[model samples]
Target chain A: MQKHFITLLFTLSLTGLNFANAYEMETTFHGVLDLRATVTDSLTGNYTQGGYGKFALNDGESFTLAQAGGEIALNWDNGLSVHAVANAYKNNGDFKLGLTEGYIKYSGLPNASGYRWQSKLGVFYPKISLENNAYAWASKNTLNSSSLNTWIGEEIRVLGNEITLTRLGRINKDPFDLSLTVSAFVNNDPAGSMLSWHGWTISNRQTLYTEKIQLPYFKARMQGYDLYEQASSSDPFLEVDDRVGGHVRAEIKFHKKGAISAGYYNNNGKPYIVDNGQYAWKTRFTHIDLTWLLPQGIVLTSQLLHGDTLMQSPLKTDVVNNDYTNGYIALSKRIKAHRITSRIERFNVKDNDKTVGDNNTERGKAFTLNYTYRLSKPWFLSTEFTWIDSYRPGRMYTNQPINLTERQLAFAARYFY
Target chain B: MFNKLPIQIKFLFISFFIIFAPSFVANATNTLTVNVVDTNQKPLENMVVYVEPIGHKVTLKNTNTLEIGQANKAFIPYISVMQLGSKVKFNNQDNITHHIYSPVGDNKFSVKIRSGQEVIKNDFNEAGEVSMGCNIHDWMSGYMLIVDTPFFAKSDKNGNTEMVIDKSGQYKVVVWHPQMTDINNRITKTINLNSAMAVTMQLSKPMDEIPSQQNEDDFDFLSDY
Candidate 1:
């Protein structure tokens, strides 16, 4: 059965590739090779291991391959194209090769009123992250992404379809541009489980497609045993409950410099259905973002997010609800080839599920500063320092204090094409 | 060398050259040399220089079609000067589509050209400066200068241009550049081109800032993302 499953996955990827090649293709190849050396100090003297350690980086000092990936984009004259990215690296001490995203998109020419439409299908990430929208989903500002975006990378991928309608304001000589996007996806029932199990953490590591993740020590402490220590990690792209999740996003650009956007995402998963030690999680979130490009190369950005995750017991009588709120404000300035960035972020999670032994209540505040210098056309050097103060009530299970403070200083050298 | 020679010899040489030089040519020819620079005296390339006869009409020499190639997401030869009523063909050499358009000009047009596609041709019946841009690539821009006179040339990298005229007469020297603040104020001076003479034009204001490597339109979620 496992062999059959592997074959099925392989077949689906090939189908996506073949569909892309059916057009008159013109291909562009690009990639980035990034490495970082990091040092961190954590309140808990005992270092975490595996996936959790990689994300938290609350362990011994080490130099590691942060990200190495390549992407090929095939654009056709008929307005059809395909984009795919692959990474080869070590995730949690296990070497793995994975596909980060792949999708086929069809874009239509603008109409008389300067309106355009596009449709995409396959496995891909959402457009909610205004920061991680660059190549390889890399953040353009700091080395470490925000806590909300970090969890997004670790446990969220949409394997379905999305469509967008955009009004080309510039072509019409208008000051504002408007767009609406809607998406329906599956295989994401396990999205919110990791956030509840691990709470919010800060790092730059992206979870590989096939790597099993280890939960924090608090998960075992509160649950009496390791609830997520199975042979395989929860598949974020698995459709256990056979329910389709959907999201809608709307954005407006003002004066070609400022943009305001809002979106709502929900996965209507049935918690009573569990497959392969993975239970369905009914998760939903509302996110809003604002960005302004001020004069003198200054950019100001802000984002607000609120969400809730719920999972029911096997008998369907008891349910656990975890509510989370996250917000951040960031500013960056570009002077020639040098960019300096600073960001302040805060987050809180409230667990209202008294029926379960485990409680996932936590709150944290973070401040980060980064400097990037463009060494050459293909080389970028960056340094970042981050300080985080976190308080988790669940820490008592591991015999540690509830309040924790962590600091990380890291430097990265990247070569991109 | 002339002063060292005998006075009689110098006079004889001057008289012979003046009488025989015009006889050796089909018509009297005079070269109009122009140098264009910014207010700070920096050599400017891509400046269009033309001579308009003050009291007489001069016919344009260029009546054939011209071509501009698009590659590397830019318009090659960013500046072009064409005669009025001359046709131009835009060719796309890159492996992508380019939507070439102009927002304000006497010859306003918008067309999409695909890779390996046939060239799109248009005629410029009106005389004015046409500003060109690619709708898909905001940084891709070009200029076309349409004139009614045949005596015209573009300033080279060293900001120098030489145009040979069939006859020497009273003419106006005009300069136009993409960054020029005022188009009407470009006619610098009027001179009688009786012999080869050099003219220098100083701009009233500094040119626009050089374009940045990072285009503002880049990183838009619709396309780049």
Candidate 2:
């Protein structure tokens, strides 16, 4: 809606630039209204593993969720500002909320040698690692650093509209920040094989960002998307909104907390998928990511994600390719109140044109451990352990060959404000 | 140089060093600036905030405060508050080889950190928030928030905070957390320290909500810890 009628004509031109008598404009606001609860148990995994803390964090057994959310603020005495965070959840069945930040900020700008320039806009989270933008209880791995979620966003996650450019270095000097973006959403393009996106077409909506001059530390990002859905059958000259496709990502952040992320997806089909009668009423994807930051703060994340879902259409003709490989190598140590964590991950999925069970290929290996204690204003404690090894092979249709293993344990305590 | 020295010996050495460095001993010093926010005003980035310098008197020449580390198996500045006996210097920088400790409280301290090793004195005078782990890494964790007030700060990255109360009263404005359910807890507020302005604590819930590196203990679903 033209960004909501140009933000109501810029707040009615700021009340028509000081409407006569009555004075207006005074601001200061704060934030937070959070709530959470989690439980899971999967020794051999299910619910698509990938995370829920790897097969439900073993030892006992459970799968639970109770969550709430908050964050709404505004402050301006000059430097101006805005803040947001909205959360919601329900999973055992499925449910969620929206937005973490809607953006609109400024640090006054105007300055040279003193250096500092900040600006934001709608949808936030992503500057990569340190757990990106923490707060799931300050994270120690609720399982997210799977190598940038298979290339830039398996769960590095996303929203849209971003513009950031900063250069403020002085710890004797060495802090540089740069960001350029163009975002629009309603994603999961799947190369125009549309299985989702009923929001009245935009071809599954996706615009992407990160492309502009980069300096001091060098950074880059580019995401592409394409979707189209309209079907009468599986094929009939494939009617996907005038043929569209999406996928492309590149990420880089050097030295100080190193980072290297890469992505390339070519999903040729997916429109709200549903038809697990042996794999996919949908599935077509490819993802990759990698990271490192260990100078006494351990963070050696890794990922080589690869996914493929195809039951039909190589583009209304010759087709064949179904692969999924996920990788992992993560280490974390967030100070204060003690915390110790460990992880080792691996997943491999296959069906390079079928040669066994459900068309063949599936592998999983995961191991983890954690402990935390922060006592001083309210005691906080945590403990955990996990292990899983899964494999599947046999039966082009039925020779049956599958094995699953699991072990998990977890503990938690909190009372924050 | 050869052309200057004679002007009354450079005006008597810049007027005897700007008029005798405060009479050489009468002594006088001043400096204060603190800023922070949260509660929606945002601007609280790293957040650690502290304050408690009422009566103990001057004893800090600043040596880059204090920070220690160990990696992966825990400890790396998750939280470290000082002043009250100060002195902390633990280092391992990780190459695998740790057995850190803190058996009892009030300043217990233990050791066993290999790999590029290092471990300085260890003299905490007690305020609270001391915890460390590593029975062979066991997912090593850390926290040392020992404070006694002289004022404190930690909230940047947009969360904001400012403190410099040399002698302010009603000293019970609490907001400390290791996860805070009770640790001699406090949440009172009265702060009237003459104001230069700064005080915010925006956190919906961030005291280790758990998500920074995964592996949150694997599963017990908390019926007991």
Candidate 3:
């Protein structure tokens, strides 16, 4: 069914492109190239190599191609547009390339009453992050994203349709604008597997649609354990229970100076269902986001998220049950051609079930400071420093410290086209 | 000597005075200066100020097409005033695409203009405030006040605009700003403008917050959000 859906989406996109050509639509291509030099001090190996480290790089100095991303858009005069973004990454002799997001959007003109409606179809990220507003879902202020947004990038992609209704404040002659959005999606039943197994992480690496995340070495996956049948790597986008999920969000914008939004998401998967070595985990969360343009050219953004996940066995017994919470506050200021940003984050996961050897309990705090200088219209130079302190009992199984502190410094050169 | 004068001579004198008296009124030139200020008495720039004759007809002048440009993801000339029936042209000066549209009254139009391209729209026939925005960039906002009369001007940085009018009688002077909290974003005062006049229009309430056109993200290479 997923294959058929993908094929149908491509077919529709082709058809739309043909129609766009006939209508003399405007097609644009934009992209960005990011290169980074990094130095890290981490005792454990990185999670990409099946270790419990938090950052993306290993414990050494290296120069790497962080990302080369491209986006193509076809916009018709009739309020319809098709957009697609793809990215490539080369890190530590490992090369990865895949599509990040593709969707068709329809934005209707505001009516006489100042109400407008828009809709999107296909695979895309949920509207939960206030930081990753740049191209290819890159964080605008810092090199690393907050824990809450990192998890969203990793596992919370929507493969369905979303509809939004907005009341434009200017046209309505009101000081406040309001919008409501609702979406229904599929192919995300295994959304919470990595969060429960590997705990929360803070990185700017977004999982591609075809990528599977590697899990850390854990005792629960060993022989004679409850999760012995679990896969070593998690396919987060797989459909295991064939159940539909839904999300609803509402926002109030103060003219255009700032906005506050709240949302609820539920992947109503039926537990105890396993398909192709992927287990269905019932996951639900509620989140709030705020973006305010403060005085003195300062931008303030923050997000708070709390959720729970459950995976059960065939006997209706809990295998992994955990409650998680993540929050962050960031402030950025721009002076002429330079910008500086700082953020503080807190995250926690509480194990609620008696799943021996599968310790999902963890707590962590992180701080990030970034400074960016605009070299030119399309070129930017940035330096960032990050510190993370975390405690996880499961790390002790691999002879690693239960309490860990890691730090990284990176300098990046970015070019946008 | 007056008593001895003929009745016809006296009647002619009175008639001449009556006939020439209205010509003096017609030839009288009125110099009007409008000062716009916020509630705190701070000068408010870019406010649209216009005078309309209440009981007389003013011929609408034919105006050249007004051009609004897009550069650095912002609309040039954030506020404008044009006569009714004038045309508007949107020019995309940046090396990017812009989808400009106004969703109000008869001025409603949506056009997609590529970089170094321009689109001319001939639908300024409506006499009302038209608010425009770029569909691609939500923060890019521009306002145009289309008035039926030709006597309209936007206030300068000092909140002053002067107009010299001949044959001005009862006139309605109005001040408009997109962010003004008044009803319809306008404040009106009816006054007789038969001589040199100065009017000060102050807001009773504070203006609504005007969103900055500068994008906080400052990234032009962004996809749809």
Candidate 4:
């Protein structure tokens, strides 16, 4: 299926390019290679080593290749364009190279009902992140994304079609514009498993498309419960409980200064049914985000998210219900080419089902401060410090759960062209 | 030696040069210094100053192609000054497609220009303020002031302009800017340029509001969705 999708994408892109040759073709290529040195300290001595079931770290300092990716966009005179991105890196030891996203977009929609309509059909991430506005889905300010956005990067992508309608206010001599977005997708049934497994984590790593992630806690729990081995590695894009799911988003803008947006996402699949070691999560979430451009190059941004996922049997006796909530507030200021940003985030996940041996209970808070100095238009040097405070009752490998506070300092040099 | 000479010799020498020398050397050029300012007296940039010859025709000899480049989603020169019959070329230097058009201008036409691609030249045969806009980019805007005379100058940041008119006669000096509120009632001065001198003009009304250069991220979406 993936191969067929790629072939179709190439054929369409080439066709667009050929048509563009009759007129004009404007193509752009942009990328960033971020090299970083990181030092992490954990209080519980449980180094954050395991992926998802992060028990402890490597618990040391090391120079690492943080992220490297790029995107290519080809535009034509006839309002046809194609965009694609690929990334290769190790997210704390899970190394893989994968196509991040690819899409064919048609933007020349006529204005009707005081609105203009556009559509995109491909594999792409939804326009949900107010922070990841930079190239290759990287955060503009800090090295790592916020906890909520990090989860979004890990497990959410629309592998289908998205339609957008926008009312251009200033173009019509109005003071404000409004927009609505609707997307239908598939091949993402495994979206909510990691959210239930790890609760929420703060990191700069994005899970690749084909990478195999290890879930130690799930493996241990299966073994401890005397159940059959349910595979050690998880694939986020497996088709399970084959179904189509979607989301809708609405946005309103006040001139060119600020905007407010709200969205609701749901994958209404049956989690009780599993296929190819993947389960349908029956997950849903409500997201609200705001961006305000303050005076003097200062910006204020905030996002609030609430959601739940459930997996259980037909009788509903043996079930696991995970309720997750997270929110973040950020302030950023730009002085010429230099930008400084700081954010505070809080997240929590509880086992509302109260099932036996439920290891999905965790609550955490994180604070991050970042500074970026742009040496030139494409070269940037930045430093970020993040501290997370949390208590996980299920992390009792030593037969005792400990309240943990982890701190990491990272310095990176990046070039985007 | 000239002082020792007769007053008639000095007068004849001066008269000889003044009459026949001007015919030989063609010293009809006179410098027209124009100082333009806002109500606050700040030197306004991108204002065009030109001399319109009255009772006679001043033929324009030098005509060139004017380029209006689109870079970073903006017209390189926010305001363009051109003479009648001047050919203008729109170049897209940025890595994107630019659909350029003038809705209400002397030359009303539209063309889709792509990166690294060239479009057909546009000729400004009529004299008027051509308000240009991009169909693709809503916030992108520009202006082209087309005039009949070649003796025009766009004011610098210091709001100072100097045009060397190769003619001495009664001429009407006119100034234009994109932000000018009254295009019909422009600030004009009728002057007799027998010699080089300085002239200052003040705008009777404040300039129209300059278009805002909002960030590109402000309207990340192309349509309402």
Candidate 5:
């Protein structure tokens, strides 16, 4: 499915690019090409091991690996649009195309609505993002060191829905910007909860989502982006393991070029959850984020996320005793045709639900720095150096903590038509 | 359901949102005249003016490097376009060098322009808007917006600019300002203009009030310049 989607998108994107939007092969491109990879050098003996799975914590082996992928969006004349994502690796994730954003939407509402009102019902992205989908480097702030079992309210979250609402604020000068989106959906695949890890979730369901709120935001030259407001509900009839709950998050950018983002979210710990209904479990999770954009394009992005877990707890089984703190500094510089990016991630994790073979608390560190040179018009090459450390406080490799630190080096080349 | 309220009240308040919403805008087609002032009623230079089409085909991309010439100590064309898939270039047209980069919007970028230097381009893949600042000069600031649609436009000194929508389509037309009245969030209305119509939108702002750029916390900008 992913391959087919990519083929269609690649053809359309290249065609669009070649003909421009003129279709006469003028190629008015309305697409995007994102290909990213890293190659690194080893520092510790056989320590570089990382992938996604219940057993990705490899015996801690050192090796070199790299991957790349991106998406292309094509807009047709009759309101039909298609977006396809492609990756260089097998099951690399993010490779599917559907009407998630294809619909014949009209601009002017019935006029009985407010100003700045417009919406699409066929398919589209929900109005949910707080840096998660904002910046490429900023998205993995918590991923660098997160344990394999932590569950977030909106972790790995997305759904198909019909929507309607408004587009508020001025692109350049509007101080108080706002957007109100209301969507309804049915028979969604339930697989994640604010109670499990990335790929965790129940399956097959129907629900409604009548989300309504006035999100007023601000963007000043001195400050980046600041949002101040509140939201009350999730989708009207959206089924989430057959449970509904309130969700919200907000943040403010300080004068010192640093930003603080925080939000409190909840979900009906539907007993059917986890225990398959034998145990009615309710859940709630809270996440706080602070990003200090220090000097020299170096970003110190940190986040503290804790949430309720369990089919039932003595107090709030949903009590989020599992706190995940992530800190990382990302520095990048573009010199000539070579772009250099260096980033190091340190994680502090503590969990209440201790799974098998897993210590209650663990500290891990990963350092990555790379350089890419756009070798030619449609090609680019990149190489990176990385270090991954899984700390075991008392154990020792020689006199050092038995903790494991794997080092790796990788290189990749890409082509964009 | 509410088709029978008094016609006067309906026109004055109730149906106001519905009546002028899908059509009339702050353009020449309307009666409102917006005089964008800097608290001083002084026409602010480099202030960007965006118009959200009611319903239309908008294009988005990332382009690093917005070029704003520096002659004196001030940044020229203070207001400019910050598209997706792109970057901004701060050229030191002045005799001396300038350490520039927005602490906010342009946080992903920074550099020192030596009299006539400029950065090639940076990345801005995702969509939305942001602000840029100069670390060396706290007072020097600029705005950068990442939009998914080409239906948006900026205004000139007379707070006027001809908004162009390539062909024909539906659009959520909104004219906004950093200091627009709290009656609501700036001014947004729906509009449908066929290609070449050249519709007139008379956008306006209330008197006695203008947002300030001083309260900014030395860097992070949540509002405007």
Candidate 6:
């Protein structure tokens, strides 16, 4: 099915290109290349390798091609457009590439009464992260994203349709603008598996559509356990239950100074349903975000998210029940070609069910400081330092310490075109 | 005899009068210089100042088409002033697309311009401020004030702008700025421009902050949010 989807996307893009030339439509292409050198003193392996570490890079020093991404947009004169983004990453000589998002959008002009309507159809990320404003969902302020946004990038993507309504302020002589967005999605029933199994992690690695993330070692995966039939890998974008999910977000923007938004998301999956080794994990969350442009070129941003997830057995028995919360505060200032940013984050997961050998409770705090200098129009140099202290009792099952403190320093060169 | 003179002599005589004619006109006309300042006494720039002759009709000069271009995902010349019934051209000079629109009544228009393309809008038949923005880039804002007369100039960095009126009697002077914290973003003063005049207009309240157009990150290549 994934292969077929890819083929369809390619066909649609090719047809759009042909129409662009024949109809004099607009077509634009953009891309970015990033390279990174990192040094870390983490005692545990990185989470990408199924370890409990809170970073994308593992212990020791390494040079890596962080990401190379390309995006294409075909725009028609009648407020219709098609967009797609593909990304590639190389770490430790291992390479992966896939599409992150592809969608068709329609943005209608404001009417006489100042009302505008817009809609999108396909696969895309929700407008949740205030940090990942750069290309390919990368953080513009820092090399490492906040824990709240990291989880969003890792597990949250919608494969459906969304509609938005906005009332522009300037048209009516008002000082504030208001917008509301609602979406219904599918193929995301297994959304909260990683947050439950691995606890919360802090990284900038966004999962590709066709990728499956490895989970940390747990006794439930062993023979003669309640979850012995569970898959070792979690497919975040799979449709285990044939049910649809929904999200609603509302935002108020005060001119160009800043904006505040609140949203609710629910993937109404049947917890007891399992298909092809993947279980339906019913998940729901509420989130709030604030971005304020303070005086003297300083910007302050914050996000708070709280949610719960549940997975049960065919016998209506509770297998995994967890409640999680994450929040972050960040400040950034730009001085000429240099930008400095600092952020603090807190994350927690509470295990409510007593599933033997599957302890998903964890608590963590993190700090990040980043400095970026613009080398030229298309080039940038950035250095970042990240420190995290986390406690997860689940690590004890693997004969590891329950509490761990990890630190990493990285320098990156990025080019945008 | 003057009409029957040699063509060279007639041309020289006409040239001499044409060269010195501006001094004669300068003596009869009045030069009005308006200076604007904020409450903190800071010189305000980009303020539009114009004078309308009361109880009289004046023929407006034919104005040229004004151009507002998009580059680096920002609108060049954030503010523009044009004569009523004149045309304005929206140009997209960047390697991207921009959807420019204005919601003002009677002057409302929306057009999507691609890279290196231009869209001409001539439906600005009303005299008012037309605020424009790119639907895609919400931070991109611009204003075009359409005045009934051509006797207007935007303030310079020193907060000074000058206009010469051929007939200087009973003129209504007005100052406008988008960020001005005043009713209708305007201040009107009725004065008799019988002689050369210098007017100083100070705002009673502080001006609102002008939003910055520069983005924190140099990610203009990104297609969507």
Highest TM-score, which number? 3
RMSD of 6: 5.0
lDDT of 6: 0.85
lDDT per residue (tens digit) for residues B2-45 in model 3: 87889999999889989898897886888999999999999889
Q: Can you write out model 3's per-residue Cα lDDT over A1-417, one digit (the tens) per residue?
A: 357446846976886977776787878788878899999887547766567778777888878888788888788888888888888887767889988888888998877777889999888887898887778888777877888888888899878889999887767667677999999998788899888877888777788888888888888888998988888788888778888999999999874478999999998988899876689899999999998989996989999999999999877799999899999999999898999999999999999999778898899999999999999988989999999999999888789889999999999998888
lDDT (tens digit, per residue) of candidate 5 on A377-412: 555576655576765432221233445555545454
Chain A vs. native, model 3, TM-score: 0.97
TM, every model: 0.71, 0.23, 0.89, 0.77, 0.41, 0.86
> Docking category for candidate 1?
incorrect
Q: Which candidate is the best by DockQ?
A: 3
Backbone Cα, N, C clashes tallied per candidate: 1, 99, 0, 14, 115, 0
Error of 1 at A216 (Å): 2.7
- How good is model 1 by TM-score? 0.71
Quality of candidate 3 docking, DockQ? 0.41
* Per-residue lDDT of model 5, residues B125-207, tens digit only: 66544444443343354555555554345665665445444444556544544344534324545555543443344435453
Residue A281 of model 1, lDDT score: 87
DockQ of each: 0.08, 0.02, 0.41, 0.10, 0.03, 0.33
Comparing candidate 2 with candidate 6, which one achieves the higher DockQ? Answer: 6
Q: For model 3, give the interface RMSD.
A: 2.3
Q: Is candidate 1 or candidate 6 better by DockQ?
A: 6
Instruction: Give per-model CA RMSD.
Output: 7.7, 23.6, 5.1, 6.2, 22.9, 5.0
- Count of clashing pairs, candidate 2: 99
Q: What is the lDDT of residue A181 in candidate 2?
A: 27
Q: Residue B10 lDDT in model 3?
A: 90
Task: Please state the Cα-based DockQ of model 5 relative to the true two-chain complex.
Answer: 0.03
Candidate 2 lDDT by residue in tens digits, B64-87: 447677765457766666656657
